[model samples]
Target chain A: MKQMRRRRVRRALEEQCFLWLMRLSLLGAVGVLGMIVGVICWRGAGALSWEMVSSLPEGGFYLGREGGILNALVGSLYLACGATVLALCLAVPVVFYLHTYASPGGRLRHGVRLALDILWGIPSIVYGAFGFAWMVYLGVRASLLAGILTLALVVLPILARTLDEVVEMTPVLLRESTLALGATRLEWMGVLLRQSLPGLLTAILLAFGRGIGDAASVLFTAGYTDNLPDSLLRPVASLPLAVFFLLGTPFPEVQARAYAAALILTIIVLGVSVSAHLSLARLGRYVIR
Target chain B: MGGVVEQPDKGSQRSESFRLSGRRRWSDRVAHRLLGLIAGALCLLVVGVAAALLLRSLPLLSTFSLFELWGGQVWQPMRGLFGYAPFVVGSLWVTAVAMAVAVVPAVFSGIYLAEYVSERGRALLKPLLDLLVGIPSVVYGVWGVLFVVPLVRDWIGPWAEQTVGDALPFLGRTSPSGYGLLSAGLVLGIMVFPLIVAVTEEVMRSVPREMREALLSLGATRWETTKCSVRRVGLPGILAAVVLGFSRAFGETLAVMMTVGNVAQFPSTIFDPVYPLPALIANNYGEMMSVPLYEAALMHAALLLLGVVIIFNVGARLVIERLVRRIR
Candidate 1:
């Protein structure tokens, strides 16, 4: 009886020790990551103000008083918006036709997915390389048009994949109804496509979020110019570019500016994603698969 | 049986629908053929670039001997003798060190959001991590240059040298180049943290809850059970995540370029100047100069790096798929 009681007591002790160790291991890691995020935000938040957001990053974010991110912010908007529009225009018909009209035995669908997977798998630097070779090499220069064109390809796979599902989810009955009405192919496409526009727009927005925040694709093709972008051929400074440019400078104030810019970029991305989720919710009934 | 077989009325109608929808009209067939060809062409485009990287690198092969590129220690390229030893070693070492620093904290953040947190917390954080991944490397490069470089040199440098002494080669040296192995690794660790956390959380969520119950029922506390059940189950997924992170960190260019001191020699110490594979390419690719061979050498480096990354990526995908099946 005495020996058995002793054994049970030892087991209890072992269990308690293991539990304590695991708790410490998991929480300790959490503490360290939290510290990193906290330090960055605390240091960065103090450097931002309304004036910094409203003007150009002319000299740098020296005091959060002199230069602003207005130029970069506007440029990112234009480039991302243009790319998103172009990608959506190309993707919508391709996606719809693949789902609604194409035969199952066709290798076209398989090829489309394979192409997207490859595009997604390859590094963004390679895209920059291709853009440099094709556009910059041909003396097209590092301009906004080249930047948009590069980003469009970079984001096309992601946008196209998501939009394919959005189109696929549209009721077969809707297509059938149009077919029975003797409507021409284009007319049917117009009506059904219009009805699914909101969901399609959501996918485009997500791609825009990705495109706007991307720095690698723009580095070679877009180049850097501080002035407001005037023509499609002109180089532009984007928000991420501002952050990138600020890092290498000598000033402590400039580093602070990079952080503040990071904060803004984070907000814009969150807004885009939230809008996408809201749109996903708006797409009711067809939400099954 | 004869009546069923002879039912031609509805069968013909059904066959007609299938045949007409199946076989395309001339214009329809032309359009189908055209679109499929276009889509196929795009696939060819991506493959074409990857192939070009290989083809562009062919000239590099004639310049550097295989043995010299792999096992040789010296990297004196100025005299036209190219050795890839320092770069390959540095890339792998930095990647391993970075993953060690990265995995633990990333797991905590992921677990905090996935398991410990309430619905509100998950809603807020999932998007933040997504944003973190979206942020550009140039910005990260900037952060590394201004903040990470100084922190390493000023604080980490002195402490490491004093504590570890000459035993730690990289820490012992003092160089003008702020580019060091440890700092670059830390910056890279932060950069790829989100990918690991995101994928690990996904895999963990799929793990059944019964294993947790079985452990807890046998007197294991929630925390203890998690370590054994959830953690053990999550190990292979985390390992795959680490490989993916390593490949990215190893192959990365601009961020590592700006931060890592761009010296060509093999680093004797962490504080000594180090060159990574991607940095070598980025710095040289733009400045291919009158020496056409220099560009060829850089292309050679890109090809080797590409081969390594693709192998690791394909392996990780397979591992993750197997892990998923086993869990299911």
Candidate 2:
């Protein structure tokens, strides 16, 4: 009886230790996020200015002399918007094909999903390299269009897969009723599209967030310029690349600007994420579970 | 058929409706074919990317043997000697270190969220995890440079050197600067932490409730029930999560590049600087285009990175699919 009581005490002690360890670990993880945001905000706030968001970079921007990252800001928006639209075009059809045309238990559906998963895993840098190779073969130069194309490839799988999950969650009875009403597959897809509108919007926002912040894939394809892009063929600056290039300079001012650029990019991403989350909850009321 | 039979009195209306239905069917067939074609093209794009990388890298392959490229230690672009040993080793060391530092804590945190937290707590924490995951890699790199590097240089490095330097030579500081494998690993570990936690939490949640109930009803403690029932059932899924995290950490370029002192060398210790494969490609691609075979060599590095990541991702996905099948 004494031995059993001792064993029970030891077990209780062990449980307490493990539970505390878990709490500490979680605190550490959350602490890391707080630190990242704190550092960026603390460093970036000083460099951010009204003019910085409005004007173009001067001749000596890299030397920390003068200029704002407006060029990069606009360029990033253009690139991300273009890529999101392009990816949406392809991703929507693919998701529709999976749900409407392909049999639920078919190998084709599985194969497509597997392909998308692998594509999603491929690094942004690899996509950049492949895009660069293709541009060279096609006799095209680094430009906004090139970046858009490469970034489209990067976000396609993400858009498709997220939308796929949303579509998968949709009630099957809705589809059966639509088809039973003498509607064709295309007509049924229309209903699915409406039902999954919020999810589709969320997917687009997520993909846009990814596209805007990605530096690796656009490093080679979207050659940075000081001026806003006038044509699809002209080079354009991006916020991620702007941060990357600015931070590399030996000048303290430039590094500060880099921080400011990072802050802006982070804000844009966080905004998109928050909106996506909110919209999902808000618009999801109309969606049949 | 019943509608048509009932509308037999209205013959002209029935015929008009039949024609309309025929046209609708034709359009549906056309749309189906079009969408199917697009999906098929997406698959072709994957194949196209792999083929393009292989073809672009062929020039380097023809010029140098695979053995020379992989086994040689020196990397001199001007001298025309391309050795990938240092980069390969560097990537492995950083990724290994990242996994080591992150796995246990992340798994623990995931379990805490999944099995221990209230529903309200889980809902609040899961979005925070998503936010962490959404932060760009460049921001992580900047954070590393500003925060983690200094912390390592002033504190961790000195403490490590004093306690374990003599006992474990690899733990010793080979370079005074804190930019090296450890810094990169710490930053990358943080970046990948949320991913592992999210995946692990998901996998743990998927473990059936009955298992936990059965174990708990037997008078087991909550911790004991989790360890015996939840972990046992979720082991394969947790493994898949780890592999997915590994693949993500391996291919990350910008953050790793900024923190990992881009010196192309085989690291003798954790503090020694090294260059990784993705960094090798990112840092050199545009500037070194004038050098002979430089582009091809970079392409080869990209190909290598892609191949390894794809293999790992495919394996993890298969494991996940099998687990899902078993659970269902």
Candidate 3:
């Protein structure tokens, strides 16, 4: 009895230690996140100005010039919008086919998803390099068109996979009930689309967030310029690139501007993420578990 | 006879509906074919990326043998010495350090969230983790350069140098500049922490309630049950999460590029500046076009990065798939 009591005490002590370790780990993750956002906000708030959001970047911008990152802000929107549209055009059909045409766990669907997973995992720099190589081969200079295409390639797998997840989560019964109504496969797709509308929108917003913030994939492909892009063939500026270029220089004011750019970028991303989460939660209620 | 009659009646009713919806049927067929074609194109795009990488890399391969490219320690691209060892080694060191630092916190947090946290707490914490993942790599890069580098340079470097530097030769002589493998690795650990947590949490949750109950019924504490049964069952997935995190760290470009002082040297110490493959390509590909075989050399590096990521991803997929099957 004495030995058993001792053993119980030892086990209890071990359990308490384990519990503390787990809590500390949780706190660490939360702490890192709080630090990143809090620091960005603190630093970026000091640098935020009306001119920073309104005017074009002037000459010697990297040398701490007079104007702002407006050009980059607009250009990022253009690039992300174009790429999101392109990705949606390609990704939706594939996701639809995966659910409607291909049987679950079929070899063809599996192969396609596996290929996408591999593509998804390929680093953004590789995409940039691939874009550069393709541009060189085709004799096309760095332009908005090239960046959009590259970003589309990058976002396709992400969007498709996200959409596929939602579609897969769609209760199998929904598909059957719609078919029971003598709905054609196309009509069934419409029902699935309606059912997964919130998810699809969330996916688009997420991809847009990704494309807008990505500096590496678009570095060489989207060749930055001080002016906003006037045509698809013209180069474009992006927020991430602005941050990179500004922070790269030795000037302190310019580095502050980089923080401002990061702030704007972070806000856009966080806004989108939070919205996506909220919508997913809200619409998720309607989805059959 | 009754079944045959019913089948014909059912067939007639279907034919009547089909006749009524002839135009809709044609459009549906068209939509199906169009979607199928798009799917085919999307799949082909992945092939296109691989093919383009190969074609671009071929020129470099034909000019420089693999021995001259990846075989040596020297990496002076300007002088045409394109040895890949330094960058490869740099990537290895950074990834190793990142995995070492991140794995414990990440794995424990994932387990805690899955097993220890209340539902309300899980709901709140999960999104916070998602927010971490959603933050762009560039932002991480900026943060690394602004905060992490300075911290390493000023405090961590000095502290480690005085305390552990003498005992471990691998720590290498500390540099006050702080732009080295250690700084980059620490930032990368922060960047990849969320990924590891998310994946490991999913894997842990899939461990099934019955297994936990069995351990609990045997008078095991929650910690003991988790450690012995749930964690043991989730080990493959945990490994997979770590591997996935490693691949992400290896391929990370902007954050690492900004923090890791871009130098073409084999690092003997964590404080030594080194160039990674992605950083090398990003920093030099533009100017490289002016030099003979320089562009090709950079392309080779790109090819190498691509190949490594693909291999890691494939391995992750296999391991995760096996884990899923085992659990199911």
Candidate 4:
């Protein structure tokens, strides 16, 4: 009993030290990351001005008077909104068709699932290549129309997969409740869609966050130019594309501007994703209205 | 025959159609067909794109002989040579060294938070990792150049030169500018550390409490029980998390493009200029216009990257599959 008591005391002493070390370590990590964001905010946020917000990405400190990111910001908004609309345009009826209409054991259903899984593995780079070929080479739509279409392709699998899950999560009784009442396919789809609208919107917000961060696809297909976009055909900078251009330069002033731009882009994405997460989370208590 | 199967139902529903109008049997059938066709067609796009990428690269399929890509050291684009040896080897070395620097501290810290830390500390520290996740890769590139690069120039470069001047040549060419594997790995490590910590912490928390309690009841130290008992149970998840983080870091582009000295040669030492595969793809994909084969080479490089990411994802899935079994 004396020996056992002595061992217990030693273990307690060691455990206390270990816990302290662990806490200190976590603090150190958090501190390092906090410093990174702090440094960006400290230096980058200073450059934001009323005029700067309206300028194009000219090559000077804050890209000179013309160094503003207004065009790219607008371009991103246009492309993102268009892509989201196109994807939903494509996904809604597809879900209704797949789960509601297709025989569960059919080969076509099996093929569709296999196709999405394969696409998920293909790198974003390859998609850029295809966009270059299909949009610019073959198609007449070579401007923002092409960019939106490419993003639509990139985000399609993710949206479809998420929606499939959401559709599945809807209690079957909700569907059967309408179906047993002799409602046609159209009525059931309308009702079920309204019920799952929040989840679908959440997927869209997530896609927006991803779309803004990606630079590669839009790089070649949405080839950059200096003028304010004359129709969708003219290439303009997006925030990430601006960040890429700024960093790839040799100038110190340009580098600082790039830092500012990157900070803006990251915060914007973080804000959207966080809010979307909360919004989607509200679905847990949703009453369908 | 398929139409006939629905015909009887349609005939029975005609009585109800008297209550409705205009929407006929043929139109409903056409609508069903159109919806199925569109959904099926939409799903085909992913496979189609992947297939298209693979097929277009078939002309140079002869060039991708794995041995040529992996075994040779040369990467001269002008000569139409595509030996991936340099870039491939560089990727492995950088990723491996970076993982060594990242994983050790990340694991211990992750365990600390998951098993040992007070709630207040955990709450404060977790957001930093989230912030790290949120920081743009381009911003990391800027900080690396402005702060990390110069710090290496002043401190690490000279200190290494003095310590190992006669003993090693690595200290000789070490970019006194800090734009080498060391800085690259440092930035990569910082970027990926959050990933491992996040994953390991999650897995540790999910481990049954009984395992930790049994060790504690036996008078094991808290760290001892958590480390040996809990970590053992969650080993596969830890492996998966590390690989996932490393895969992401390996594929990173803009940050590596800005910070990696952007040189095309195989790395000579911890300090030599280098390029990663994704950086190669991003930098040259648009600019290699004077040369046609060069564009093809970039595409081939992209294919190479896609191959690696697929392997990483597949490996992670296998580990996760094992985890699922154990949980069940």
Candidate 5:
């Protein structure tokens, strides 16, 4: 009886110890996130100004003598938008086919999912390398078009898989009813599209967020230029690369601008993510669960 | 006789409907073919990426034996000597260190969220974790350069050297600049933390409630039940999560490049500077065209990175699939 009581005490102590350890680990994990945002905001707010967001860089921008990062701001918007549209065009059809035409739990469907998962895992750097190789073969220059194409490839799997998950969640009874009502496969796809509209929006926003924030895939394909992007053929600057290049310079002023650029990119990503989360909840009212 | 009669009646009714909705039937068939074609094209694109990398890398392979490339240490593109040992080792060191720093804490945090937190807490915390995951890798890189590198240079490195230098010789040599494996690994650990946590929590939550209830009825403590029931059942899935995180860290470029110091050498200590494969490709692409076989060498690096990541990703996916099947 004495030994059993001691054993009980030991067990209780062990439980408490582990529970505290887990709590501390949780705190540490959240603290890192807090620190990242805190540091960026503290440094970036000081350097941010109306001129920084509104004006383009001048002759001595890299030297920290003049101008703003309007070129990168607009360039990132254009690249991300273009890539999102391209990826959507490809992703939608593939998703529709997987749900409608392919048999449920069949090898083809599984293989496609597996393929997409692998694609999603391929690093942005490899996509950039592959883009560079293709451009060389096609004798194409590093430009906005090249960047969009490569970024599209990078986000395609993400868009597809996210949309796939949402579509997969759709009730099978709905499909059966639609088919039983003498609807063709194409018509059923229309219903699926309408039902998954919120999911589609979420996927687009997520892909755009990923595309705009990516630096590596665009490093080689989208050659950075100081000027605002005027044509698809022209090289374009991006906010992430802006941070990279500016931070590498010797001038403190330049590094400060890098922080500001990073701040802008972070805000954009944060907004996209929050909206993606919020929109799902808000629009999910119409969804059949 | 009744089944045969019903089958003929159904076939005639289907034919009649098809004849009545002829245009709709045509449109459906056309759409199906078109969508299937797109899906097929997507599959082809995946294969194309791998093939293109392999073909582009062939030139370098033709010039150097696989053994020479893998084992060589000199990496002077200007001098026409290509060696991958340093970069390979550098990647290994950074990834290994990052996994070490991240896995335990992340798993603990994940378990805390899954088993200990209230529903409201989980709801609030999950989106925050998602936000962390969405933060750009470049931002993480900048954070590393500004905060982590300085912290390491000033405090962690010197403190470790003084305290543990005699006991472990590896801790004796500190990189003066603080831009080395340890800084990169720490930064990467933070970067991959949310990912591992999200996955692990998901895996743990997938464990059946009945199992927990049964254990609790037998007089097990909450922690004891979790250890025996949830952890054991979710072990393979947690492993898959870790592998996924490993693959992610291995292929990350700009962030690792920024903090890793980009020195092409086999690091003797955690503080020593090192170069990784993705960094090699990203940094040298601009100048690669000027040197013979330089572009091919970089392509080979990309191919190597892609090949390894694919293997890991496929393995993890298969494991998760098997686990799901077993659970069902």
Candidate 6:
């Protein structure tokens, strides 16, 4: 009886220890995130300046010269927006095809999704290399156009998969009713579009956020320049690249500028993420199971 | 005679409707096939990327024998020494360190969130994990430089040099400057923590409630139930998560680049500087065009990186899928 009681006490102690360990792990994950964001904000705030956002860089910017990342900020927006638009155009049709045309849980649907998953898993740097190689073959230089095309390829899978998930959640009864009313396949697509509009919007925003934040993918393909890109053929600056470049320099001022660029990039991503989360929460009701 | 007449009239009307809709049905079929073709073409894009990488890297393959290119330790592109041993080893070491540091906490957190936490707590934790995922690598890189590197240099490095360093011969040769394999690995570990936790949580959640209930009824404690039944069922999935996280760490560029001092060497100690393939490419791609075989070498490196990552990801997916099938 005494031995049984001792065993029970030990088991209780072990359970408590296990629970605390698990909780500690949770705390660790949250702590790391909080620490990273906290440190970036603390350091980046000191570097943020009105002139930095308002004006372009002057001469000798890399050597701690007076300059702002206006060129990079504008370039990043152009690249991200362009990529998101182009990706949406391609992704919507593919997603629609998967849902409307393919049989439920068919081989073709599985194969296509598996392919997309593979593509999605391919690292961004690989996309950059592929883009660079393709550009060389096509006799095109690294420009805004090249960056957008490359980024589109990167974000296409993401947008398609997210939109596909939302579409798949759409009730089969809805589809049956629409078809029962003698709706054409094209018209059915319109119905799916209407139903998944909120989710689709969220997907686009998420893709844009991803495109804007990725640095390695565009590192070589974007071909950064000091001046703002006026034409699609010219090279462009981007926030990720700007942060990467400035951080490399030894100068304190330029390093601070890198932090500021990071802050802007983080803000954009955070905004998109929050908006996506909000939309998901609100529009979730419209989705029937 | 009346039934026969009605059947003939019905057949005639059906034929007329079929004829009337022929052109419309043809267009519909065409549209369906067209969209299917587009979707298939999207799948083919990955194959195209592989081909492109192979074609681009052929120049390097021609210059150096396959064995020589992969087997050589040095990677001086300017001097035409395009061996990839150091970079590959560097990548492996860093990823190993990251996995070692991250896997335990990630698995624990996954268990906590999936089995132990309240629904409200799970909701709060999940969004925070998403936030972690959304934070850019560049931000992590900057943070690493500001905090992690210094912490390692001043405290962790010295402590390790005194304790683990004395015990382990390789660790005895430590760098006073902390930015090296260990720092890069730790930062990568932190970056990958959320992904690991997320995957683990999913795998743990998929363990049916009945299994937990049965274990508890059999006089198993919550910990024992989780460790024996839940973890046993989810082992393959946990491994898949680790593989995925490892791939993420292996391919990570900017954060590793910033934290890893770009010395082209096989790190003898965790403190010693090392350079991975991604960093090598990112740092040198600009100057590569100027040099002769440099561009080819970088292409080769990219191809190698892609092959490794794709293999890992595809293999992990297969394992996870099998695990899901078994669970169902």
Docking class of 1: acceptable
Ranking by DockQ: 5, 2, 3, 6, 4, 1
Can you give the DockQ of every candidate in the order shown? 0.23, 0.78, 0.75, 0.40, 0.80, 0.72
lDDT of 4 by residue, A135-160 (tens): 53365544777777777776676677
lDDT of each: 0.70, 0.91, 0.87, 0.71, 0.91, 0.86
**Candidate 3 residue runs with Cα over 4 Å from true position:** A286-289, B1-15, B18-20
Query: Candidate 1: deviation at residue A251, Å?
Result: 5.0
Clashing pairs in 3: none
Model 1's lDDT to the true fold? 0.70
TM-score of chain A of each: 0.81, 0.97, 0.97, 0.81, 0.97, 0.95
Q: Tell me the tens digit of each residue's lDDT in model 2 across B58-153.
A: 999999999999888998888899999999999998998899989999999999999899999987888788888889999999999999889889
Worst 10 residues of 1 chain A by lDDT: A25-34
Q: Which ten residues in a row have the lowest lDDT in candidate 4 chain A?
A: A57-66
Any runs in candidate 5 off by more than 4 Å, and if so which? B1-20
Top candidate (DockQ):
5
Q: Please provide TM-scores, in order, for all candidate models, with all chains considered together.
A: 0.76, 0.96, 0.96, 0.80, 0.97, 0.95
Q: After superposition, how far is residue B253 of candidate 6 from its true place, in Å?
A: 0.8
Better of 1 and 6 by lDDT: 6
| Chain B TM-score (each prediction, in order) | 0.85, 0.93, 0.93, 0.81, 0.94, 0.92
- Regions of candidate 6 where Cα sits further than 4 Å from its true position: B1-27
Off by over 4 Å in 4: A1-6, A13-29, A57-67, A89-123, A133-142, A157-192, A278-289, B1-46, B63-66, B105-131, B159-173, B201-225, B228-232
Worst 10 residues of 2 chain B by lDDT: B1-10
Worst 10 residues of 5 chain A by lDDT: A102-111
Candidate 6: tens digits of C-alpha lDDT, residues B1-328: 4545454555665656444265667767887989999988888888999999999889889878989988998777778888899999988998998898999999899888998889998877798888788777787898889998999999888787788887896775367778898889899998889989988888888888888899999999889999885557999999999999988888889899999988888888878888898998888877777888777788888899989988998998898888888888
- Worst 10-residue lDDT window, candidate 3 chain B: B1-10
